[model samples]
Target: MKIYALLFLVLCLSQQLHAKEIDVYAFCDASTKFLKKLSVLPLEDLVAVKSAIAASSSLEELSVASGVPYIDWIEDTQKQLLVSESDAKLIVFEQVKPIEFSRYSRVINMHGVKDHRLWDKVLNDCVSVNLAALID
Candidate 1:
């Protein structure tokens, strides 16, 4: 029994160590060239992406860096690359978030909007169509 417990602990530790790390992508439109370009972003670019995560960074920075105003979030869900909005909108893995978003980003970009009412609505209603969780 002790041996079994030890084995279980070891397995858990190994799994934790080997867990897949999430990757970040910003999209402005659905374009193969854009997807391919993002897939091969340099280490510096990767750092930029990492910094641009929600609350930690802004998509504007990514836009300035990449010359694209749109962004998308992509992750591996159930062995398939799932692309989705933070609001749980499902998009093709290669699809880019629209620059002229009427919902979240627009409000976010608006002057004196002050409250994240629009963003909160989308976030509260977020539901994954392909994945178990929306934000992971």
Candidate 2:
């Protein structure tokens, strides 16, 4: 019986570990060429990008302001609304949905990466109206 219990515990731990190793797709707007053009290291680039996002007046403003061109901001909004539905506290995919297209009026999408100083700044600045916490 003890051996069986130990085996069960091991199985459970393995499952939990696998669950935590989730795959989330992170995307930047196509307009974010400014960051892309830089040859800096990943850390430096991310910091610079974060600074820019933090300074934006709103998410819509951020999207427009980003250096990546051709990014579909309209599609991004739909993703936010969908992630907000499950009470999941985190969104892990990359695809943008279709429902939020009509409402995408150069508006803000509060969903963003976790642990980003810019994300916190946006939260404090009232740029992201929904202010959903993102995953790191």
User: What is the C-alpha local distance difference test score of candidate 2?
Assistant: 0.30
- The total number of steric clashes, by the backbone 3 Å criterion, in model 2 comes to 9
lDDT of 1 by residue, 25-128 (tens): 11111221233334444545444443443222344443454354342222222123232344222331112222212222322333233345743332333222
- Candidate 1: TM-score? 0.22
Q: Global CA lDDT of candidate 1, please?
A: 0.30
Instruction: Give a tens-digit lDDT track for model 2, residues 14-110.
Output: 2343424422111122212212223223544445545555555433445543443223333333343443422211121121111112112112232
Model 2 RMSD in angstroms = 17.1
Worst 10 residues of 2 by lDDT: 97-106
TM-score of each model, in listed order:
0.22, 0.22
Off by over 4 Å in 1: 1-30, 56-66, 70-136
